[model samples]
Target: MFAEIITIGDEILIGQIIDTNSAFIAQELNKIGVSVYQISSVQDDRAHILKALREAESRSDIVIVTGGLGPTKDDITKHTLCEYFGDTLVENHEVLLHVEEIFKKYISSPISELNRQQAWVLSRAEVLHNEYGTAPGMWIQRNGKVVVSLPGVPFEMKHLITTKVVPRIIEGFKRPFIVHKTMITYGMGESAIAEILEPVEVRLPSEVKLAYLPSLGSVRLRLTGKGPDKDQLNALVQSEANKIKALLGNLIYGEDGGEPIEELVANLLIQKNMTLGTAESFTGGRIAQKITSIPGASAYFKGSVVSYATQTKIEVLKVPQALIEQYSVVSAQVAEAMASNLRALLKTDFAIATTGNAGPTKGDADVEVGTVYIAIASPKRVIVEKYLMGSQRDRVVQKSVNKAFELLQKEILKL
Candidate 1:
């Protein structure tokens, strides 16, 4: 079955409010084997709403609409929907009571005519009750097509769609079976990963589709399959994923769209009952911030010191001034000193340190722009990595943090 989503609001068109409802609806519909053909954003006008509704209904088996249902005079979705369906708006006593009860529980005020008008429903539409808000959802049908109108508020719309709308649509449509698996890869750029897996990509089954979604530091390879049964599709996707993993190996960090790299590292550390700390230079305190975002991080995360200045690296982190003078601040020797210094200072099981020129300009005569050196100091070993990142300062900082986490993970694996 095919579906179309219409998000009705001038706010969306003007970029005042993001239309997250369509994305939610699309995901839900996709899981249920219903294809979302198109998504539209229309202004809060009666004529435009009607035109969009007609166009969506003509092309889709299911039409989902959001917004324009409010207590104010500008809200005209219910009236326009009534006109389109050749019906009239009539007061729904149950919806009015719900509105009054909500108001009494919260505002403790008398009911107004505008609120009553807002509760009014189209005569031919099925009322989808809203538990979280005042506006009741409407399900209207015309010319063998389904049109579901939901509240624009994200929470209220989500509840109605999940509890009420999705169930009804599932009952009416013969949905096919669909499954999706996502692989989260790191330590490789999108182009590099693609180039490495070019042969596998070329031989992919027609039923399975692959999409690369790249973010700041990693790429998520999502494989989606649609078929008539569950077991076959699952086997097909699992086989494809195994092939991709064998080709990519350690470059594929976590699978099935797992949490951020920090979470991945935290899980590994927690599993090993290991403690960790950091000494930072160019990335400030971002690495520590990412580590602490994981719950129960204190179980393994020891501490971090932002030694951006050479003086801080020497004084606070106890990096030898001779080392900085001999090898410069953004050098492997300084990075190793910072790591070993923090490991001893915090008395943790492990420590990670970064010293880098994350900049749009040169930091040292020998070290060009975006020169980064990351060091991991464990009880048994000390490993350092060198990378000449791109010219973008923020990208250099972010990629440095990710690489530091990757190094931490690698050291943990060695242990």
Candidate 2:
């Protein structure tokens, strides 16, 4: 089954708040074998909301509206839903009791009239109790399609969907089984990878499909299969995945959804019982930040030195001043020295370093914009490589960081 998601808020349109609810709801729906048809963000204006709802119902079997369910005046989703359903707003005693208890126990204040109005819901709707908030979720059935109204608060919306919406969907409709498998590959652009996988794609079955999700320096290949038989569908997708893996080989780093590059590196370090350190020039401490973002990193991560300036590289990472004079701070020689010194100073078995000229105007070096050098210091040797990332400053820094990890991963595997 397919569903459409509408996020009703002026805040989302004005960029005051991000519309994360659509993503969360879509993922949840996908898990239950329901696909999202379209997602829209409309202002809190009544005409816009009504138009969006009408359009959504025309295209999808289920329409989920989030936000605009608050008790305040700008919150009109509840009233709009009632008008659409040709129903009236009525006080629900059970909802009122829950709201009162929440206030008395948690909020510790007398409920205002505005807060009490949260108990008034669509007369034709089935109330979805909100254990965490004042606004109750509404479920209405019209002409065999489902319309659900939920609070915009992420935590409360998540609770209502998990506890109420999903169960009702399963109980009411028959859904096909959907299976997804993702594999990560680095060092190759999407066009290059696609050229190799074109033959494999041509052979994929009708029910199974391949999608490429690309990022800075990597691409994630996801195989999604849908059918009545879960095991058969899973096996079909896995069989196709094996074909892709056979063609890609070691180019594929990790698989499934949790396979972030940093997490993969962290796991490998833990497996080998090795410690890591980083020295940074253009990337700042971002490499260390990505590594430490994973839990249990303290066990394998030694430390980092953000040698962002020529003096800092000389003073902190102990890169020789004479070398900076010979080859600028953004050179491969400086990057290699930074890595090698960081490995010895931090007493880590592995070290990664980044030095680059990411520039609108060159700060220290006269090199062109996007010139980057990434270095890795292993137990046996130190290696550095250069690349021209792009003209964009942020892109250059991020691509440098990704390339650093790629170089580090290759070195780790050598050990």
| Local distance difference test, each candidate | 0.89, 0.91
User: Candidate 1: how many backbone clashes?
Assistant: 0
Clashing pairs in 1: none
- Tell me which residue pairs clash in candidate 2: none
Root-mean-square deviation of Cα positions for candidate 2 versus the true structure, in angstroms: 1.6
Stretches of model 1 off by over 4 angstroms after superposition:
257-259, 360-369, 391-393
Q: Give the per-residue lDDT of model 2 (tens digit) for 29-48.
A: 99989989999999888788
* Model 2 segments more than 4 A misplaced: none
